[model samples]
Target: MSVTHEQIMLTSFDEASARRALALAGEALEIEADAIRKLHARLGRDDSVPRAVALMLACRGRVVVSGMGKSGHIARKIAATLASTGTPALFLHPAEAAHGDLGMVTAQDVLVAISYSGESSELAVVLPAVKRMGVPVIAMTGKPASRLAQVADVHLDVSVDKEACPLNLAPTTSTTVTLALGDALAVALLELRGFKPDDFARSHPGGALGRRLLTHVRDVMRSGAAVPQVAPDALLTDALLEISHKGMGMTAIVDADGRPVGVFTDGDLRRLIEKGQHFGQLRIRDVMHLEPRRIHPDRLAVDAVAVMEEFRINQMLVTGDDGKLVGALHIHDLTRAKVI
Candidate 1:
């Protein structure tokens, strides 16, 4: 693996090209970020945001979002964000709506039409029908005097000074502003409706927060015969065997009442060996750690994770109201359950 003269020269040229590309990327990101900031600034002074939110908040049916070209892509994303965040929303392609999908809208629904130029002919064909149905149309456009804006019930001005594109012809900054406004509308509606995390979990059951909120200790803990345990009088060898047989890497030292009094892990065995203590001279009660961390079966599994992370322990005991050991948990259990 040696570099030739041409290869070295090519590497130098590639570095310069890469630098230019990175600078361009940074500029584009900055431009998009500035557009969002401007949108945020306008939100403080503009009543359009609150008015649009009110319409959507009062809507009995889903929010029907429509756009054309690049705006259409942003509209679809906005609809997904709205739906996932408690507002019922779906994207309706303008061309498709003109063809037949306009029937999906109703008087009970709110229509959010996105067009940078506000002169999308495809959207124009469907706007009249939506207006005739008495559905409230929230127009997100760069031009306030365009046909779509004139026909809309609520006009949200999403104009940007110039696009991030070098030619200033592409829908870059304007689309970003429109999408930000869409998110602003959805967030406002959700806030006014008092939507909670549990509500969001129900909407996104497959997401990380959903798993944490919905999964319980009983659902993931090792129970019954799977829980590793030993009597206080049990021999160190016997406890070791219990831990090994259960594959929990630890065993709970229980009283005659079957309640865990202490816990002994493989770490304890290692320390005993390092101290030159013979296994024959030790009892489970003598070596085990007293009053181990424990959680209730009904508590969320995420709570268990917090306890383990705070105490820096890998295993936890699950106890019932009777103070009897019902189950055990290892960090591996959480990993396997995808709760960690």
Candidate 2:
């Protein structure tokens, strides 16, 4: 088929269109990045940022985040982050506050009000009432001199030089800055409260991270006779049989007291084969790896994974304080539990 002049022009226009779209995306990223950088620079100069965090930390009740329009959307996310990071928080819609949702705010709660202009009409109608109820307000806004900022106990300046939008009307850079500032506040409060990973894991128990932190070795380990084991004096062939029957790719070489003296794995079989050793006659004690990696039943399953990864092994034995083998675990167990 021969291409017509019109077809050639259409293809050129399509290519130009793609290039323009990519250019616009890059410009938007640059604008947002610059806004964040400005926000970062302003952090040290703004005393209110620390004071706001301190207020939230001292709050006896939840942090109630309230805003309007795009700011409201950001406020909801901020509340979620705060709640998840150890600070009790919830989002309250300013528009709903005037219609009696203001009852959600209590004197014990700290109010975080967000408005780029610092003069959202919905917020204006409710702030005085919230203040009257003795709820301290922390205002996040671009206009420091605006009514919302003036009335607030604390003001967080989230001003951007310009919006990422071409028209400079739609909230893009400003909203980004506001979201980042909210995250900063939440993280600061998290540090102040000494929120540990274990505590965070408890709050996020449904996630893979929670499984890693909360699941104990005993929870996923094979206990009792299911744990592959062989006497140290047992023939290599017998150990191999135990490994095969248990399907753990390894067997613990235990003493008469049932204490793990060494481990015999598939890798040991490979090494013995390469050395032309007779598996039928060789004792497990002769070829087993001593000082095998082991973990206590109470240790985190994730810690078991760390040991396996560090030694490049697939299985580890679980031992009691007396060094007696109580259980065993394989890499597949961690994979199944999503601890890896």
Candidate 3:
């Protein structure tokens, strides 16, 4: 028997096996969603919003977040989210803090302690030092009246009805709820401080989000000697030479005052040539698209990418509100910048 590429590629799953996998995945999603809903329900109690917000705002030093085991993992993520969203925060391992890391905590800092049981030994060892320094502590735990919670300034109750794990041993729904609550607190602080998207971009200056928000049209646009520009009254032959010199596949047709009047592209030239029109006698104004898409230099690059996609255009003319041409950007510019 000969095995072909098609035969090798056509392997199939039995119906029962496929259904079981899909059903389990859907059940897990439902469990996680329920956990989030229940957690959100707890936000209004004890004026948690005002207290948590005040705690973060009053801290002169960085917010220190700590936890043990699985809860520790969630704590680290929460700390990262807080740091990126305008609030200064860092994660400190509870065990490490007990040994000499307590030196990192200062009178001006805020300590956020995380433990599902609220009785982690490592957390217990570090509690006295955190208090001695006059640092305020916020505890996240299943038990509000537990030792860690009783001693802390604010206690956040992350109690879940049960874990999603069938064995009831793994930290599933509880961990997710705790993480969600942390995000809620961070975002609330972001709103209170009037944190803008540009502020967020400043902290994350290396990825897609950074490129999308931090990048200005002036940064990625073809400017100076690279801009394909021609006066509106110039002959089509002159516009073609500008396009060739810039290699941007199009030339901006500007009025006598230097404001963009129209755009002439390779597409326009092909159509004109097919109509037997002579480039030598035609003016750029006669063959250019009268209303080409345009964007402002101060606007986000993501917005520029959106406009390009909506109009199916390759390039957009960057302009100032004063109607002065500033620069030009191609769809490829956005792609290379990862704004796509």
Candidate 4:
């Protein structure tokens, strides 16, 4: 809102400043790592971690995570992790919850309140209302004797010896510990639910793992009239024309019943050209590689990628159970579909 003509100027940064910065950076990481280690040891010292997991898993509704300031950021991240990993969870801003957002918390829901000092005034108001609704509370805090922890149904101690900041006032180390504890709970619930890759994919359809798990051969394969095919008796030049028109680098040689008998590719055409053979007289069967690599339509597209990479082939045919040429796939198709 205000500006001054004065500014501190430095002609250059010296090695001493760089060294001090690097040292602090390394020390911060070490402090955070130690905090997480302490959090793990605390879990071993008590049954709070398992008890917290049990409450969340037993809940018929969502896990409502709430906190203030830096702890609030960690609360949001924890809610997202739990939701994506099979537990239904949401983040409720503490200040907002006291101002009517508390209605989001139901009697069947579990409240996860995060407060480093256990004195977040906003959460103090929400805890009472949530308690009245018969909702259980899981509190994460640095002070076990703090009011928030004392009132919680389950207490998770996320205490850290000191902050990574030189002033020992910032929440760097404590926040990392809180976030990690939340992840541990989500993963525990995930394991208990027997959540599989497909289940995770359903919730993360836009992610890479989701693409690999949910995209099927039929989804990426060129099917129907788009597949490049020529009769086994067709001329080699005709197969070449089919390959060029379809732009699949190859053409399938199918029998009268539309079953793939073989495949002729650009490599075949090159060898034919080198031999100076009469492309005009040669049939597709004359140069076709018999028994083309094939896959099922129902298989995951990632599985098709494996088959293509294993055989070192760029093109593959999709065959039905009766061995009919139902579709085709080129490596480029997988790339276009973001399945590669």
Query: How well does model 2 score by local distance difference test?
Result: 0.93
**Best of the candidates, TM-score:** 4
- Residue pairs of candidate 3 with colliding backbone atoms: none
Candidate 1 wrong stretches, greater than 4 Å:
1-41, 44-46, 275-283
Higher-TM-score candidate of 1 and 4: 4
The lDDT-based order of candidates, best leading, equals 2, 4, 1, 3
State residue 30's C-alpha deviation in candidate 2, in Å: 3.7
Candidate number with the higher TM-score (1 or 3): 1
Provide the overall lDDT of each model, using Cα atoms, as 2-decimal numbers.
Answer: 0.90, 0.93, 0.87, 0.91
Of 1 and 2, which scores higher on TM-score? Answer: 1
Candidate 1 achieves a global lDDT of 0.90
Give the alpha carbon lDDT tens digit for every residue of 1-340 in model 4.
5444342223244668878889999999999999888778778888888899899999999999999999999999999999999999999999998788887888999999999999999999888889999999999999999999999999999999999989999889899889998888999999999999899999999998889999999999999889999998898888888999999999999999989999988987888789888876888897899888999999999999998899899989999999999999999989988987
Which rank order by TM-score, best down to worst?
A: 4, 1, 2, 3
lDDT per residue, candidate 3, 88-120, as tens digits?
999999999878888888888999999989999
Q: What CA RMSD would you report for each candidate? A: 3.3, 3.6, 4.4, 3.5
TM-score, each model?
Answer: 0.86, 0.85, 0.80, 0.94
For residues 67-96, write the lDDT of model 2, one tens digit per residue: 999999999999999999999999999888
Give the 10-residue window scoring lowest on summed lDDT in candidate 4.
2-11
Report the error of model 1 at residue 95, Å: 1.8
Per-residue error for 9 in candidate 2, Å, reads 13
